[model samples]
Every structure is written in C-alpha cells, then in structure tokens.
Target: MHQAALLGGMIHDASHYGWKVAQPPHDWRKMAEAVQNHVKSLNWGHRVQLQDRKVKYFNFKASFVNPHMVCGVSKGGEETLLSADHIVIATGGRPRYPTHIEGALEYGITSDDIFWLKESPGKTLVVGASYVALECAGFLTGLGLDTTVMIRSVPLRAFDQQMASLVTEHMAVHGTRILRGCTPLRVERLSDGRLQVTWVDLASDKKDTGTFDTVLWAVGKP
Candidate 1:
C-alpha cells in the first residue's frame, strides 16, 4: 500500500523535502502485479485468510519444526511452531476508531477491508487528516470516485505545515474534494449497502449529513 501511494502521485512534492522520499513514479498497477507474482512464486501453503479477529500474542512454543523459514503458521486447528533460529514479531498495529464517534465499526470500513472491495464506490467521504486519509482519498479519487476529505482541524497535522499544505493543494487540483474543520459523529447504514454520514463541522455549531459509498477514517490512526 505504501508503494501504491508513491506511484499514485504522492511523490511530486514529497521528493524535494528531506522529510519523506519516494522513487520516480512508475506504473503502480504494474508494480503491484509484479509483487503479486513474486508472492505466488513462493507457493506458500494456502493463501492467508483472516478471521477478522485480534491476535493477542505470538503463541510461540518453539518446538515443532519445518524445512523453511516460516515452518509453521496458525492455520486449521493447529498452532504448530515454525523452525527458525530467530523469529521477528512483525504483527503491526490495530484499527482504532475515534473516541467521540459511535458505531464507526458498524458502518465504517477499515483500510484492511478497502482493497478487497468488489465494486467501485460512487462517492467516498474519507474522514481524518493523517497520511492514511490523504493516501486513501487520493487513491479513491484517482480511481474516479467522488472523494470528499473531511478533517477536524488540518489535514496531515503531524507533518510539517508546508508539506501538508502542498499535499492538500495537489489533491484539490487532481479532483479530491477536501472539507476542512469537520469530524464524523456516526455512520448510518442504508438498506442499499451505502452509508449516510453525520458529521459535525468544528468551525460552526452545525451538523451535516450526506450519503457516501464508504467512509475512511484516518484521524490520528493507531
């Protein structure tokens, strides 16, 4: 996903600064295809399937052994140990919804779920200003969805102000609709599988509601 962003025009103004760097833009889809082929080469057991649950810890017994590095994995009904001299714990972070918002999970879709979408969204209102938000909105809009970015304060608040502003401007010119100074309250699911977003504009004591195909949360992502 990080590589996808680099190829999707995030590298234009990002390369000059010493902050973040990306290679010269190339065919992102091609890169992704190449990666997929490489992964297929390994012929690693069955494709890893998710049960949509949290992994509390590594159930390491360090006993069961195999010939390859990933000797064993948690699959079927077994937690067989893999044979290796060193094991790296690369389990990444978890999804965290906004504290004030309710039913985010009920109506919202996390980054993990976005890639597997079967249909393209007609409209997407992405919430949050972090890098996740920026990249997701950019990707969605680039794919021809009407993407609206909503932020409570400023987008990319953690980054340097200048770079963040540059990203914001680039996104605007490319067709991403950015709505600043707003936060989502809840996502209301419609019968048609679309979502109705209820958001509070921080600048004004008013509420706004709109229908969207999906709502992406990128606010201070955990």
Candidate 2:
C-alpha cells in the first residue's frame, strides 16, 4: 500500500531525470488485486515449505484441554484431540476497535481491512496517533485521496517525540490534514451512504461533525 503511494512521487520526479511522462491515473482495483495476489502467493510458498519439511498442518480452531492436550475443531465441526510433550502458544495481536463508540464496528474499518477493500475508501477519517495511523493517512493522501487524521494526543507516542513532529509536519506540508487533540465520539451512516463522524475537541470541549466515505481506527492492538 505504501509503495502504491510512492509511485505518484516517482512519476513527478521523472521529469528531473529527462523522462517526460504525463502523470497517469491510478487504478485502485488493479493495485489492490496485485497486492492481494502477491500476499496469497507468499502464503502458498509458506505452506509448500512446511509440506516439504514434513510438517502436519491442521486448519482448525484449537483449545487447550489440559497442559499437554489440545482439542481442535475444524470448519466442518469435526473435533480431534491431540497430545504432545510440549505446547507452544503463538498468537499475534490484531488491530483494536473502539466498540463503545456508536456504529463504530458496523461502519468503520481498521488497518487490517483498509488494504483489502475492493473499492477505494473515497474521503477517509483515520482515528488515532500511532505510526500505523500516520502511515495509512500519508499513503491515502499520496494516492490523491482526501484524507484526514483525527489524533487524540501525540502521534508516534512510543517513539521519539521530536522526530514524530517532523514526520507529521512533512505530511501536513505535503497535504494531509491533521486534527490534533480530538477524539471521536460517534460514527453514523449518512443518507448518501457516507459516514458521519462526531468528535470532541479536548481543549475546547466542543463537538463537531464531519462526513467521510470511510472511518479507520488505528488506536492500538491488544
């Protein structure tokens, strides 16, 4: 997704290198299909490597029955019990959603689903201050979409704060709108099929509303 965004800048730079080419239109569907297909190919490669290593693969939902025993349930509802000398749990975190906000889960998406979207999320509101949030906003802006970021506090909170400011400033100078010290209160679907986001300004305690084609939450992950 980020690479897709950089293609535009590269086109602009082409003139400096004597490649006088016109700025071409971006095809979201084509880029999305290519990315998805590449990801699927990588997954297939991993499966093949595992198979060649003589590893038994089970596509199942597993639950620990005891310290050494596990119960696995398949998609078709078949269950099996397996015992091993050792058990290793390796679950990864996923993007978190603010379920308390009205219509959040129903109307909004996250970093996980944005790239997978078949259609472009026209005008977007990205909520949160993490690097993930900024990266998404930057790419969307680079793709020539109307993108705004609603930040509750400092962006890149865990990283170097001074550098974070520079990163955000660069984005702002390049055309991304940054809404600081604000948090979303609710998300509602509008009559025209757009999303209406209501947010509050932390400093003024004032509420405001804006409509967008998509709302993305990048708050954090558990």
Candidate 3:
C-alpha cells in the first residue's frame, strides 16, 4: 500500500529527468486487490512450510488446559485436547479503538483494515500520533488525496522528540495537515454518506467540525 503511493511521486519526479510521462489516475481497487492476494499467498506459503516440516496446524481457538495440554475449539464446535512435550503461547496486541467517543467505533477503521479497503478513501481524517498514523497519512497525501491528522498531543510521543519533530515538519511541508493538541469527540454519517467529525482543541477548549470520506484510528494497542 505504501509503495502504491510512492509510485505516483516517482512518476512525477521522472518527468524532471526529461522523461515524457503523464501521471495516470490511481486505481485504488486494483491496488487493494493485488495487496490482498499477495497476503493470501503468504499465508498459504506459511501453511505449506509447516506441512513440509511435518508440523500439524490447527485452525482453532486454543486455551491452556494444563502446562502441556491445550483445549482447542473449532468453528463448528468440534473440541479437541492435545498434549505436547512443551508449550508456548504467543500473543500479539491489537489496535485500540476510542470507544468513549459516541460513534468512533462504528464510523472509524483501524490500520488493519486500511489496506483492504475496496474503494479510495477520499478526504481522510487520521487520528493518533504513532508512526502508523503519520505513515498512513503520508501515503494518503502522496496519492493526491486530501489528508488531515488529528493529534491529541505531540506526534510520535514515545519516540525521540527531535526526530519526531523532523518527521512531522516534513509531512506538514508535503501537504499533510497536522492538528496539534486536538482530539476527536465524535463521528457521524452525513446525508451524502460522508463522515462528519467533531473535535476539540485541548488548549482553547474550542470545538470544531469537518467532513471526510473516511476516519482512520491508529492509536496504540493495549
């Protein structure tokens, strides 16, 4: 998805080198389908690799029955208890949603679903200050879309402040609107199916509203 946006800029830069090229319109659907297919291929490859190693893979929800035993339930209510010499549990965190906001969960999408979108997300409003948030906004802007980022406080808050400043500055110079010290209060669907976002300025305690085609949440995971 990131590469998809970079291609546009590369094409434009090529023109400066005396290359006769016209920037073609981006086809969001085509790019999304390609990305999705690539991910599916990777998944299939993983399963094949495990099979080659003579490993049994189960598509089930697993719970620890004991230190060496586990209970797994499949989609159709088939339950099985398997015991092994050792056990390992790997848990990856998931993105957090702002459920306190009236309509955030219902109207906003997380980074996980952004790349799988079927259509272009026009005039997008991205929420959060993590690298994921900045990177997503950056690519969306590079694709010639209207992009805005709403940061509750400083951007890249967990990273080095100086380097984070440089990144945010670069994004601002390249057409990404950065709303500092602000937070979204709610999201609503307008009559035209566009999203209406209401936010508040932390410093002034003032409320403002804007309309967008999509709202993306990139807040950290729990």
Q: RMSDs, each prediction? A: 10.1, 1.5, 1.7
> Per-residue lDDT of 28-64 in model 3, one digit per residue for the tens?
9998999999999999999999999999999988999
How are the candidates ranked when ordered by TM-score, highest leading? 2, 3, 1
lDDT against the true structure, each candidate = 0.70, 0.93, 0.93
Q: Model 1 off-target regions past 4 Å?
A: 1-73, 77-90
Let me know the TM-score candidate 3 reaches against the reference structure.
Answer: 0.93
Candidate 2 on 106-213: residue-level lDDT in tens?
999999998799999999999999989999999999898899999998899999999999999999998899999999999988889999999999999999999999
Question: Which is the leading candidate under TM-score?
Answer: 2
TM-scores of all candidate predictions against the true structure? 0.64, 0.94, 0.93
